[model samples]
Target: MKSSIKRYLIGRPLKSNELGEQKLNKTKALAILSSDALSSVAYGPEQILLVLVTIGAAAFWYSIPIAVGVLVLLLALILSYRQIIYAYPQGGGAYVVSKENLGVNYGLVAGGSLLVDYILTVAVSVSAGTDAITSAFPSLHSHNILIAVLFVLFITTLNLRGVTESASILAYPVYLFVIALFIMIGAGMYKIFTGQVTEALHSPIGTPVAGISLFLLLRAFASGSSALTGVEAISNAIPNFKDPAPKNAAKTLAAMGTLLAILFSGIVLLAYYYGISPNEQETVVSQIAESVFGRNAVYYFIQFTTALILVLAANTGYSAFPLLAVNLAKDKFIPRMFTIRGDRLGYSNGIITLGFASILLIIMFKGHTESLIPLYAVGVFIPFTLSQTGMILKWLREKPAGWRVKLAINATGAAISFIVSLMFFLTKFTQVWPVLVFLPLTILLFHRIKRHYEAVGDQLRIASCEAATPIEGNVMIVPVAGITHVVENSINYAKSLNADQIIAVYVAFDREEEKKFAEKWAKWQPDVRLVTLHSQYRSIIQPLTKFVDIVEHKSKEMNYRVTVVIPQFIPKEGWHNILHNQSSFLIRAFLLYRRDVIVTTVPYHLKK
Candidate 1:
């Protein structure tokens, strides 16, 4: 029944041979891998305005400069990650680069920071998308959290269907969003050219909270840095591309970067020329669409696609987080389960884990995009700095052709990204302190997990090398509830072991039940010896395990190997099995952990 539900939700299980067939082409790869970066234009410019607007209309002009700075940073990242895609086509992103070049600890830090950013991508993107929705309707504003959570779950399910399948489904919406924005930008530009809208729609009309200064500009820059959050995803997922993965991925990255630059600059330009101010209720893009095509289908189209692409932006995280988790798992820094692929060949464990974590963040922040923006960029730029730094070291160490130019480019990126990261930390310290605290703690946890895995490996290796302990004979103890077929089956299986001694034991709460059981056993006249144990506390497993312990103590000097055979009744229907006492499960659970004891279950299937 569970399998049926899973099949219906995520489609039928995909075979391993079908994996390569799932690699995405350039267009689909752009939609799947670049959606986050593309979709950031919806909120990235807005985040910049959100900071600049604090100083009122006087500072609104700074949005363009801040955006240009962000664009410059974007170009740096694109160039750096292009190199990354080609240099390390295997695609662990920052984790692989930093770990290989810098060391394991730096790699883990990069990995952890990237993980946190991926989670924030989902939260912030969905929340920003929800803000877009609320802007359009206004009535649904109160339920934004619920709306955002539903969208997160929707995207999660979509991703669980497998990467290529998700790309096919998501491709149209992303393209539609791009088309809608371009049309809106062109239409807005035509309006300005034709002089249909000569003046700014709404002039800034408030006292400046603080005068424009270097600190304010840095804050605005840091806020706008959210635009660059998903830039690394293309590098991280090069293997998800088609034949000639690296070249295809690099082309897609360039294409995505180009689109992002055009859309982001256009939006910020329109917002400034139209004199649009950041609204708590409606977004700046929504206002721009209204200014260009007021309250019409085009306007709603912009809003709808903006909401859609933002929600799908979470797809970047969904796509990258699982792959990153797989890398960490392979290194023994996380549980090995993350390394296992699901029936659909995607990393289901990592996908589902990212889903739940993002949902939690949405709830905690109450789907407020502004509240989440402060915490978003630090995670992104930390890895950005580390990855670029790693690449610099790579170029120097490997000295590939044109290594000097490569080193200079990476050095520029590393310096710029490091400055941006520091600015984000200094400007948003109050809100971002938790993330700063999270980085060290998460890295420490990774080290501890690695240590645990190493310790386990050492113990396993030692055990394999040591001599086996000598055994005198086998003693089989079968716990019986009554002289039923299940118990009879268990005893027969125990006798088949050809042990030195076999004991059928019963634990009874009262003398009456014990007498009845004894009479039944006596009439059967089983070959094995029968022992009865009395439980004053009405506990069955305790008395049975106690007897096994006593037998083990008695045979300790001789080293007799004790085996507990548990007889479990198997109901034809799975749900019916829950109605039974489950004593056999308890006995096995208790004895299976013992060093000297062997536990096994013999099942008797019932027809009805």
Candidate 2:
């Protein structure tokens, strides 16, 4: 029963042909791929300021340089991954890339990293969205965790329903948010350039603080680099795209990159221009909205957009987690259950598991985007580094007839990404070391599962030692608590057993009731003999044990076998157990202690 439950939770195993039914068109597919990248704008700026806070308000200006650097990194990474999509467009993602070029351990590391990042993406986005809403309505601030958990539950249920359903629901809000953000940024930029900017409602400048260090700048870079988290989603989801997978995926990647760059730059620059302080502020989006649209409009707009983006960002994981699981299952890294398709042809078990994990994170972090930000970027960067490195290795091994310049570009891209990843890890480990823990744990889990499968195969390969033979006799035992359906079934089973002697013993705590029952049974069945046993404490086990001993003694004297019959009822009915007694198990156990006596159960099915 326990094994059955585990199998149900893990889902059934499936094959490649089963996945053909899940094919998605380019537009819907692009939405799934771009969700994480596009949603980063929701919290990316806030993360930048969170790091800069230590350096005081003046450090806010550093956001511009960091944003610019992120833009450059984003373009480089996107172009590199575009090559990835073209080369292996079947959605092998970092796992496939690293395995093909960098070896299996590297592939496992990359896969684990991406899996962790996908979970964090959902957690952080949902938490950030909840925080934004609670910020708008401070009354809900204290209950943010509960609210976030509820939101996670809702999103999880939606995703479990199917990927296409989730994608369709998410598309409108995400697109609306993108359009709104662009309009706001464009308007704010116009206001800044035209010298029409009003002073930020709450200027982050003029705040005094201590000295700044290179470490502070590096930390800021690490935080700002979070903007690059979702770029790999495109590569992971390439297989879900319409025909011409590589071209569509590349177009989606490029589109996502350009929009993210423009949005991140605009929000950061506008915040700086309006003198919005990053150190003592809400999200950069909030500050920009407040600066451009005044307190009333921007406050609510930021709230709404943040909520929209966070919810939509979860769509990335909704699509990616199952696909990754399918890949892992195919490679035998994970259990075959992960490879299964659901009724909707989606990786239902994987989606549900990812959703549940994300919800736990949201609950633990209380939907605070700031709290989740540290753990967010590290896993993403690990995969980014490995993936780019894989691309370089692929380029070296395949030596495809790509232009020499392109090969050099891929190598340079890989080198730079690797350096950035190392830097980010060093700077952010204090904050993200938890995710580092997850990486090794996941790898260990994979290997352990692999070993388990191999062990099972080994066990099943062992040959049977003995041949089968027919039994000479079969003895059945039935225990009855009262003269009801239970006893009736027991009598039927005893007759069916065809044993040498069938003993029907009534364990009587009350002498008067025992006498009445014996008289009644004698009148009903003259052939069946009733043995009445006395119990001072109304205990079933002691009386049944004594009765079984008597039967064994008689069997030895008469040279005949003893069979005890126990009547069992279906446990599914609610009141069956309450109305009936559990004498069957006790009687069975008592009879087992005796060498010659055998016990059997007679089942009585009750309507639920």
TM-score winner: 1
Question: Model 1 reaches what TM-score against the true structure?
Answer: 0.95
Model 1 CA lDDT for position 263: 95
Instruction: Find the 10 residues in a row with the least total lDDT in model 1.
Output: 200-209
Q: Candidate 2 regions off by >4 Å?
A: 1-22, 198-214, 279-281, 297-299, 403-409, 461-568, 571-603
Q: For this target, which candidate reaches the highest lDDT against the unseen true structure?
A: 1
Scored against the true structure, residue 46 in model 2 reaches a CA lDDT of 68
- Residue by residue across 470-560, what tens digits does model 1's lDDT show? 8989899888877688888888888787999998898989989888888889779557788988899999878888899998888776888
In the order shown, the candidates' Cα RMSDs to the true structure are 2.3, 6.7
Each model's TM-score, in the order given?
0.95, 0.78
Please give, for residues 1-608, the per-residue lDDT of candidate 2 as tens digits.
Answer: 66465345433444547666456666676666687788787677767777776666666777777787777778778888888888888887888888888888889998988787788888887877776676567787788778777776777766665565667777777787888788788888888778797655324554444676666766777778887778888788877776777888888888888888888888777767777655322566776777688778655865697677776687788788888888988878898989876755677788888988888777776576776776777777777778777777677766778746556666666665676667666876676677667778899998898888877766667464444433455334344456787688778767865765556777788989888988888887666667777789978788777767776676566555667777777777555677766667666766677877766667878766
